[model samples]
Target: MNATNSQSPTIVLVHGALTDASVWHGVIRLTQAAGHHVVAPSLPLRGLASDAAYLESVPGPIVLVAHSYAGSVISHPATLDPKVKALVFIAAFQPDAGESSAELNERFPGSKLGPATTTVVPRPGGNDMYLKPEAFGEVYAGDVAPDVVSVMAAAQRPIDPAALGETLPARATWHDLPSWALVSTRDLSLPPQLLGFTARRAESHIVEVESSHAVPVSHPREVTEVVLEAVRCALS
Candidate 1:
């Protein structure tokens, strides 16, 4: 777990639905500038278990950072390698055993938090879907600038809806790991209060930023600070 040794906690960036790892470009550069290695993986988004497994496959100093739907991916029951230091959630879901995004959203029906149209659909190919651009911005990037939202929105990939529906079998990750959460004040997709609830649920060290759901892009400085803090806390 020492940087000098074989392991150094590299930040593993997990993008939200309908987007690729590139969505983290700005944040990645920022993190690297701060002298931390980052890995923003392109998740299959087909199932929570599969996505978590894919992420664990990356190998080496990994710290799980799940955005939006990928939260479920990190909270999976199986242990992500011991090399993983901690988790950073960017307006991401933080769930327990037997929970799914659909079940969680059901708690807040008809959320103005999301876009006028929802792109989270049934499996595009098999068990995943992606959020549409309008929904991506209106719901996910409402706080982000129009231009940034446009580009990040266009780069989004489709995720399978099954990922949303897939419930967690083991909630150990939530309880076992040390957690940090960055709340996007202007997020329309999940609603601000929902994020607050998440902070409380995970008992995380909460940091609220005046950004959109895409906090990593909308507020890279703030995001970088939190990430840096996580690294220090982990190594300490």
Candidate 2:
């Protein structure tokens, strides 16, 4: 490969909370076939620092792509490398410096858009909650595949509610990297508008899909297109 093509950007898939990297299974093959390398890790579910550290172990100069709560996991500098060329968020939270996911839950009274699960757990490693599946499809990712959503609801690992309460000590590449975002119009959890707000911080190239929050599974073609674009950007 030529020198320019020699450094093709790799796509790092970061799945949201209560799920593992398997959540991205569908898109991986397509990405690799399209001529990009891909790496997605299972966040330790341990805590914020450990999870970020785990992700940092992946090869550098990555095009980090995150979905749902996984976006927060990628916000750390340890998980972030200098060669990381860009970021792509799929209905994911891309917070600016000194910002927390709490801002997403900073509800205006009567605002009906928040995680609807009755139980929220605080894992020792980070902030995440294992909400019920029915409650999940009803709230967080109603648009996801039924079977996968069922599995996610049933096997959801506990997340530390305190993960949100405590702040990380690093920067998200959104401030500097070339970024892109995929937003769903029918999302009930984070509301489409709220996603717009989170996306603004990214200064990203946005793709408004008419689907719901579980965008990767629901709209693989669209998600793949965005990933392709990010790879092209990074490799350029």
Candidate 3:
């Protein structure tokens, strides 16, 4: 699975809360054009342990790319599947062991994702959280076009409330993997400061881009570049 090998490693793009795998559409196109295989799996948005277990089941020799809440999901040590050689966090949370994504989000104060910007729908066992459509563009995709933001708003996914508070069960896998991160400087969903803090703590190769929380859609080229860099470094 190293760079010298004939087969290219897979690039698994994982989306975070309030979005689905479609969030990786642009990144997938670019990465695929560059001759790499890419897959964006739809996370169930359940609690952390279950979500990480689901991610672990994806076939590997992989460059795992995570956006937003998926950061916490991939941070689980169980996701350290032997073939997951690298981690790329795109404006995402990279929590340490015993830390929850909610905790990380509040660690720094610029996040605008509070009750005013979100809605909670009660499901049988827990609550599902969604970004309010009217606030989605401002809070999650401010840099994107209005029409595209409308479509994204309509298609946004809801995450279980438990996912936010669910603590990482063991050590962060990033501690054992080569990692990279993109800090969305203008991001309003998760504060850019929080992103910087976690990325620095993980010692990931970091890039700062002026984007909304939706960096994959707003700055796909930069996102793709980071993912490709991780692939090159991890495989080499």
Please write out the lDDT profile of model 2 over residues 1-236, one tens digit for every residue. 11233468668898776667776877886776676677877776556566667777777778889887667777666665677888888887776566666565463122233455547654444445666666767665567767878876787655566555445576676766788888877776556787787787668899999876667877877899998898888767
- Each model's lDDT: 0.74, 0.71, 0.91
Model 1 alpha-carbon miss at residue 125, Å: 4.7
Name the TM-score of candidate 3.
0.96
TM-score of each model, in listed order: 0.88, 0.84, 0.96
Judging by TM-score, tell me the better candidate of 1 and 3. Answer: 3
Show where candidate 1 strays beyond 4 Å. Answer: 1-7, 109-116, 119-128
Clashes of each: 13, 11, 0
Q: Which candidate has the highest lDDT of all?
A: 3
lDDT of 3: 0.91
